[model samples]
Target chain A: MHASLVVSGLRKVYEGSGRRVEAVRDLTFTVDAGELVCLVGPSGCGKTTLLKCMGGLLTPTSGEVLVGGRRVSGPPPGMAFVFQEYGRSLFPWMRVGANVELPLKQKDLSKARRRELVADALESVGLADAAGAYPWQLSGGMQQRVAIARALAYEPEVLLMDEPFAAVDAQTRADLEDLVRRLWRQRGITILFVTHDIDEAVYLGERVLILSASPTVVQEQLKVDLPQERDQLRTRVAPRFAELRTHVYEQIQAAKRGEPS
Target chain B: MTDIPPEPTRPSAWGSLPLRVLFVFALPALLIAFWWLTSDGSTNVYWPPLRTILRTFPDVWTRARLRADLVPSLLRLLAGYASAAVVGVALGTVIGSYRKVRAVCEPVLEFLRAVPPPVLVPVIMLFAGIGDTMKIVVIASGCVWPILLNTVEGVRAVDSVMSETARSYGITGPARMRAVVLPSASPQIFAGLRQALSIGIILMVISEMFAASNGLGFTIVQFQRGFAIPDMWTGILVLGLLGFLLSVVFQLVERRVLGWYHGLRDSSRRSS
Candidate 1:
């Protein structure tokens, strides 16, 4: 199967005022069409750098990222990113509905079509009544949901989420994880989700790509063999789930200790 | 997980509705009462009694004077203020958005801003002539500085995340500026506008006082020159009233335009 997104030999070095730091070094990965891939790593492992490079928000020092077979030098079309900081990502001045509809205005769609898409997106996120409410008026979890609805409304072929549930409570995080899985299954859109939580990586992703510490590279890729249908209660307590999470956790500990992948 | 948290309610710093109203008007009312009591039947020439000024107010500001003086003055003020707002916002957005432009214009802007605007009335008159244009130009010149400078700062301070979000979604050019940039920078822009309004008023009266046949400032000068002490006092009162009225109107517009801003700030403050 052809890959929908490809990162080849991606390297990003920050050089400023006579100080140099290599954030991401020689990273290579791929996400096939309709695949849900999670990227996990130790803190400061440059997951954000890789994601930004893939999303075309940041240019790689040496190498290339291809989305839909086209090289990404700048933010490419039909791709959306959900930042960890939802408070900053969402425009506070816009209402929940307007925030979702903002990107749709860029597409060549009729007003009725745009309105329909916005309504459907909001409804999917269970925020249909919050259309007129400003983002800050809602709770942290609800605001993040609005951000997701915005990405959904854009009808993106590839969605990139960077630690999207990091700031929410554990219960809300579980609910949002389910929401993501459900949406991915329903829409069949490719997603590259980045996180540092081992259990979350094991739970949400079909395949997990673990990275080494700073000046990072992919340490390992482990596929989940658990049942396809996952629930917060049962799947989490399953013996196989425990085993996979343990392997991921140990790999991350080794990475942090500077063991070569 | 099913229900969202309720919106936080803001604690009122000022108590009940009636008490809040009283708090707002108490000082001004006390001052007015003191003036009325102290100035009752005064024999002073320059400081006429409060009743004499109030009585002369209608006679001095008759319908003819309203049309000939007050109307023209306000029209010039409106034209100058509107022009200043447009030019200030336009130029400020450009200057704020580009680093090179900001660097090149910073020193020149600082120097220009330092020179008191009233001092420029003579220079403006030389170019705009001793007509309404001169008065309008003078007002606009003073008003533009605050609005322009504030706009530049606001534009510079636009949130990076929001800007990146706009770009990632293919929202660019004028659409991005209008939807993302301008709204993000509006709070600072409004602050500048508030400052410019008062500056606009000051420049209006000063320019009229320098050279004009009829205006609030001109009429006040005429009254002083003709020894119409009560009439002069009334003209001053009219100027004060006009400024107060314009400020109230500006506050209403600002509240409407910045409702989201206030709501966001209040919510964040309460949550934190």
Candidate 2:
């Protein structure tokens, strides 16, 4: 059975120096097995806080996140996270291949098997020749590709990406979007992508979960009725793509206006 | 827009290697030449000619007692510095990683760190006697602070996102420390080591000067007291050369160990 994610009433309150800031309040969502779900929200909407809660990086003030029916108290074994700051997330000291192989070292895999996995992941990301190079030597897009390779090499059941393409240029962002879609289809790995870009959410996910401003809740979860085989140019210009984009865009605006959905 | 500037030409072959070396050694060579020329015929009691000091170098250095003193001094320095390095890194890692440990030890460590090693030589001699043990203890106490404090700072400065990344990947315990934390903190740690090496050398001489019967410092002092002015000059010259050689060796080792950090920094600098 494919691993699914269930974040139930996940509320996160940051208490510091007698001041309580409720980041995510009573938020509930589920991403089905093998599904590509995009979480789109306004800035300061606690989308990152919610993702951290789901990944078990941050403990929720109340509620819990479950992966494959097991509550996540710590980082779940089947999950891998791709952080927004690719520069900081990937180890600068390690070569691209070593960076990809690092998480696998924790697994009980043979050295040869780990090497093979790193090679395959790098190849899949089109960074096969860049394996020996350090992350700092690569361009921003290439570095992010290495980050993706690291996540892919882990062979995770659920991949959590926190605005993975935000730092790259438009063209590179489109390329990465296709890369994510291809990987999801090829591996059937469930993905929960968090982004602020409405168009990106529509272009990438099967369903887009819209989040409201602070004391955040799921404002709406819209199903994207686009074709499975999505292309950057063709899929984006499609009538259905525009409709889905506009729908998500308007919902985010209304949510930002503090309207209760 | 202004016209583009022409590209700068590379230096000539002579300028690249031969001239570069000449330029680097020019001041020292000139100073030595000046000293030799000025002291050629001097008959002053205290300021003996450079020739006499040069003549006495072989006499003092080639003696059987030279090995006896020099070897012991080097061994003590090595032992004390090695012990300090191991203990300092271990304790520093513990202090840097956990908040509780750091909070408890901060005040005590600071107080101890403020006291110089030379100052402790007499105090240490009282407890341990005027022996190798006392000398080593004094050297270690003096050298440990730089390494310990640097390690603590390095470990504390590790990027939060990087640590989070490590945690999320299930890289915990010693594996995390070895792979992520140590490497991240390495540049700072190396900076500490470099600082400690110089301090260790200074302490080595100071500790021996205070109590030990034989060492470079003791030998120099002995020559001075016995009115062997040329021998005293030779001793000072040998100590200077030793310090220079030690620093050169340390720099080579540092370059090898911190090659990755340099490469990363250089590439980033070029890109920016």
Q: Which candidate is the best by DockQ?
A: 1
lDDT of 1 at A57: 82
**Candidates' chain A TM-scores:** 0.98, 0.97
Candidate 1 off by > 4 Å: B1-11
TM-score of candidate 1 to 2 decimals: 0.97
Per-residue lDDT of candidate 1, residues B145-229 (tens digit): 9999999999999988888888899999999999999999999999999999999988888998999998888988999999999
* Model 2, span A1-261: residue lDDT tens: 444999888889999999999998888888899999999988999987887888888999999899988999998888999999999999988988889999999999999999999999998989888877778778888889889999999998789999999999998888899999999999988999999898999999999999998989999999999989989889989998998898888888899899987
| List of clashing residue pairs for candidate 1 | none
| C-alpha TM-score for every candidate | 0.97, 0.95
Evaluate candidate 2 and give its CAPRI docking class based on DockQ: acceptable
- Give one digit per residue, the lDDT tens place, for model 2 in B1-272: 11212222333556567788998899999999999999989998678889888998898898686688888888888988888888888889999999999999999999999987788888999998999999888878888998999999999999988998898999999999999988998888888788888888888888878877899888888888999998989988988898898889988988777766777777666668
